[model samples]
Target: MYLKLLPFFPGRVCTIQDPLAAAVSFDGTVSTVSDTSCSYSAVQDGYSYNPDSYVYVDFDAHPTVSGFVDRTEHVFKDTGADPVTCPADDIQGCSFGPVTDKPKEINDVGTLALTTQLGSLTFNAILGVNQITTLYTDDTLLIFAPVSKFDELGGLCGEYNGDPADDLTIRDETVTTDAAAFVTDWKTDPNCVSTPARSMLRYHDQTSLCSGVPQETVSGFEGMCQDIISPHMNITDLAKDECLQILCICNDRDIGACEASLEEWFTTLGIVDQRKKDPLDLAIELQSAFL
Candidate 1:
C-alpha cells in the first residue's frame, strides 16, 4: 500500500490555511501541523496523512482539476464568451504569475517524495521561504476544503479535479497508450483513496473565531507577528533531528528519521510567525483584536 502511491506524494501541502495558522488548526478537533505546512492527522480509516494522495479544491469554486499535476488553477483557459485575455500589466502583485511550472513541481521531494524520506523533510523546505505566493493567506491550499469534500473529489487537487459533484470515472493504474482509452480508464476508476489526512489541513481564518475580524495579515519579513512556539523548545527533538539528518542519509531510514525528526519537524523547523507587539500576550491580543 505504501509503495503504490509513492508517485503522488509531493502534493503534501500544509493542510491548515488559517491567517494565524502559525498556531494549531482544527477541522473538528484541532490538528497540529509541524512548523512547516505539512499536516499529519489520522484518516477516518486511520491512514497516515502523508503525501501519498493529495486532494485539491477550489477555494472560490470548489472544483477538481483535469489531472493530479493540474490541480485547480487561479488561471483558467480561454473559452467562447469569456476568452482567456491577458491581465492588464497594471495588475497589483499577482501571485502564481504564469503557469510556467506546476506549483507542486517545486516541492523539495517532487510528488513521490512525500511518501519517501527526502521530501518528507517538507518542513525545512516550506518554512525557509520568505515570499508569499498568490494565496490570500500564508497557509497551504489543502486546508481550505473540509475533509469530506476532499474525499469526494478524486483528490487530484488543483491542476486536476474540476467538479467534485461531477461523476468521477477515473479508475486505477491501468496504463494505456490510447488517449481515449487511457482517459476513460483514468476517469472511470473509483477515485483512489490515497489515505490523505484531511484532518490536518483544517486551517480557517481565526480572526472571526478567535476575535471576530481578521487581523492585519503579517509575514515573517514584515516583522508584525512571530510564529508561536511551544513553551517547550523541544530540545530533545532538536537533537534527535540533527542526528537523523546526519545519520539517515547513510542508513536509508526515512520512517526512523520522521520518528526522530524535531518538533515542528514535519512543518516549519525555523520560520516563526511574523513579529507582533507585546509578543507574550499576542495570542490573547489576537483574539481581542481579530476575533
Candidate 2:
C-alpha cells in the first residue's frame, strides 16, 4: 500500500534556543504547523514558540511520521522541571547582589557654601550665603545685637561640623535669649564697631544659624548623594573656571592678555565664547580643561 505521508502538523513538542542565547527546552505541542516549521504551545513546561522558534526534528528519517517520537527528540532534554540554573559568578553591570563595599562618605557641607562664606568674609569683609554678599553697612544699622561680642566672627561661622539637617550655631556669651533685643542693644551700642566690641554682624538671612558653633550635620554618603542629586548645592565648573580666570587676570595685571589666553583655551575646547566673551563660560560648555 503506497501510503501518502502527512507533513508534521501542529501539536508537536520541541526544544529551541532563543535569540537572547537562552537555551529553553519545551515539552509543549506545536501550533500553526507548516511544512518547514510551527509554533510551540508549552504544556508541561513554561515556554512558547512562534514563527521565529525552531524545533529539533529530523524530517528525512521520518517521512511518514508527523509528531515527535520521544522526549529526546526535543532540543533540550527534560532535566526534571526545576528552576533554571544560573551561573555562580557575578555578572558584570548587573546589580543582583548586595554591594560588597560601601561607597566612601563625603562631607555634607558643600564646598560652594563654605567657599562663598569664607571668601566673602576674607576678601570683602562681608558675610554672604549662596553667593549673595550682604554687607552690614551703616545704612542697615543693626537695631538689636548681642550684648557680649567677639573681635571677629570669622571663628564663629565657617564650615558645618555635624549633620547637614541641623542648623549651624554659634555658642558665645554674646548670644542672648532675646535675639531682637540683643541685636538692638549691640547696634545701639557706641562700641558696635570699636575697640573691646568691634563686632561685625554679617547676617545670612536665608541660612539657618543657631547659638553654637557649626558642626557636620550630614554623613559622607548623604553629602555626596545630595551633591550628585542637586546641581545647585555645588559650584559649577564655569564658576571655578571663572575664578581661575580672575586669578590669572589679577596675576597678569592685564585684562587684554588674560582674554587672549582664555580665547585660545576656548578654541582648543571647541566651545563658543558666550556670556560676553567669558572664558570660563566656554570652558564650562566644553566641560573639560584639555587646553
- How many clashes does each candidate structure show, in the order listed? 48, 26
All models: lDDT?
0.21, 0.19
lDDT of 2 by residue, 1-291 (tens): 000001111111112211000111111111111112211112111111211111122111113223211111111112221111111121111112221112211112210101111111211111111111111111110011011211212111111121111111222323333322322222212233321211122222112211221324223323333333233223334323232322222232343433333333222212111221454431132123212
- Given candidate 2, what's the lDDT at residue 214? 31
Model 1: per-residue Cα lDDT at residue 142: 26
Could you say which candidate leads in TM-score? 1
lDDT of 1 by residue, 1-291 (tens): 000000111111223222111112111212211121121121111122222323212212112211111112222111111111112221222231232211322233321101111213211111102111111111222222222333332222211222212221223322222222322222212333222221121122222122322233212211211112232223333222222222222132232322332233323322222111225321232224222
* TM-score (all chains, Cα) for each model: 0.20, 0.14
